[model samples]
Target: MTVVIGFEGSANKIGIGIIRDGEVLSNPRRTYITPPGQGFLPSETARHHRAVILTVLQEALEQAGLKPADVDCVAYTKGPGMGAPLVTVALVARTVAQLWGKPLLGVNHCIGHIEMGRLITHADNPTVLYVSGGNTQVIAYSERRYRIFGETIDIAVGNCLDRFARVIKISNDPSPGYNIEQMAKKGSQYVELPYTVKGMDVSFSGILSYIEEAAHKMLESGQCTAEDLCFSLQETLFSMLVEITERAMAHCGSQEVLIVGGQLFVIKSCRFFFSNLTIFLFSKSVEFHRFCIDNGAMIAQAGWEMFRSGHVTELPDSWITQR
Candidate 1:
């Protein structure tokens, strides 16, 4: 079995995956746990990426029982990621490729998420809804490229969640979505938040501000706990996203929809968004949960797919240092 190593450390989480003939052998992710009320800082995230990437790569190789010599190729996310973090992963990948004289392939991070979703869900030619800290788009593969049919004109889904979590004083955790998911599960009372949808693209910036205003009003009025407002906020934003995704799917003439990104782990926070879709929701669940986040495995998967399709050339030095 031909083995390949992929590197992912574009933003906050560092991920490494080992693939054998397009099948994942190991997928691992780790986040630099930020203190309460703090979203990821680029420099801090890059520092963390440098600290942990080697360990992850080694562990992934061990899981596959393959050494650097045994691997045939190395893949890394090329662009559309943080510059410093991307450089760290790229340096490692280029060094590894040079050392083993293995082919090094670079891939797009956005496309990696989409291809990984397709690979895991087997959702052939379906519309993809990618929601992450940096992105939220309704996309479809056509004419040799993944096209974004619908997306956020403003803030990304995960960013909205993180910002909202900060307002509610709950950002000590690695993922704000997880914290919001827990809060959403705890309380009641419908505080109708802003519902803004601009055609196929949605905007969450206004909603984030609205949720904060409502929460503050509730506190001043002494009507509800922070948890109640959190519940309402989750419900409102998720509803808006679902509405847009369902509409995009309809527009693309696809009944199949695949959800990809780290935020999907808090299914509780977003599953309700998909409640209105009448078609069968094919799970885009990867072979490993860690691959769900931004990481190396996703890049590798995309690279391997591109390579098999004869779309790539070995260039260890070709790296996307920035978006």
Candidate 2:
């Protein structure tokens, strides 16, 4: 059985996990939360990661009951994330691999989410809707690679939610998306918001701008509550996502639909909304919560797949990408 340790510090979160073949041994993570009305900067996020990463790594090892020598290889997120946070993870992963004399592998953050979702759900050949703090895309496996079928032409869905949360002055204790979801649950009013979908791609910048102005005016005029705006935002944004995802799935002729990144919100919006589509919702399985979101075990699992496929990152070639 192969054992792999993975590091992920691609954004505001820092996580370390170990996987033994198909089973996750341990996954531990910490988030860098900003105060209300503020967003986490890359430099601050990286600093937070550097502060807690080693402690989290030790926790993972302890939880997995494994020593460094027992690990077969080390893996880390390589790209499509904040540069500072990605580099922080890559540097630590490289150091650990060299110290342990283990092979090093670099994983794509998006592929990490996809592989982990597949691992947990066993949904083969599903149309994927990947929505995160920084990424939004509809993807399908084709020609030996996961090709983008549709995506955001501007900011990601999660970013839209986060920016809206800032506009409304919501606390970022757990997450902006989570806060918005909670607020949306109590919302009754459906304020009109712009819904922009350009062919296969969607745009959020316009919606964000429009809502920012509307939120200020409406909240000041006592016309709508913050909850109302939150609910309206979710409805509009998720509808666009569902529309594009449905279109992509139909085009790809896929039966299974896997929701990645903003799992809870997307699942709520897309589940049972698509006629005759097999929706794989990970939220039902409590064990999948960590895997559903950004975590190190996903990175480890992706790296394990790559390593078994004879892929490895040499020391000299290890680098980060912010695609």
Best by lDDT: 2
1-323: candidate 2 lDDT, tens digit per residue: 88989999888889998999889999999989899999999999999999999999999999999999899889999988999999999999999999889999999999999999898888878888898988999999998999999999989999998898998899897788877887888899999988999999999999999999889899999999999999899878877877887788678866667777733355554432343222322122211111257899999999999988899999998999999
TM-scores for all candidates: the values are 0.90, 0.93
What is candidate 2's local distance difference test score? 0.85
Total clashing pairs in model 2: 0
Judge candidate 1 at residue 162 and give its lDDT: 85
| Structure candidate 2, residue pairs in collision | none
Candidate 1 has its poorest 10 consecutive residues by lDDT at: 282-291
Colliding pairs, model 1:
7-296, 8-295, 8-296, 15-296, 36-172
Displacement of the residue 57 alpha carbon in candidate 1, Å = 1.4
Global lDDT of each candidate? 0.75, 0.85
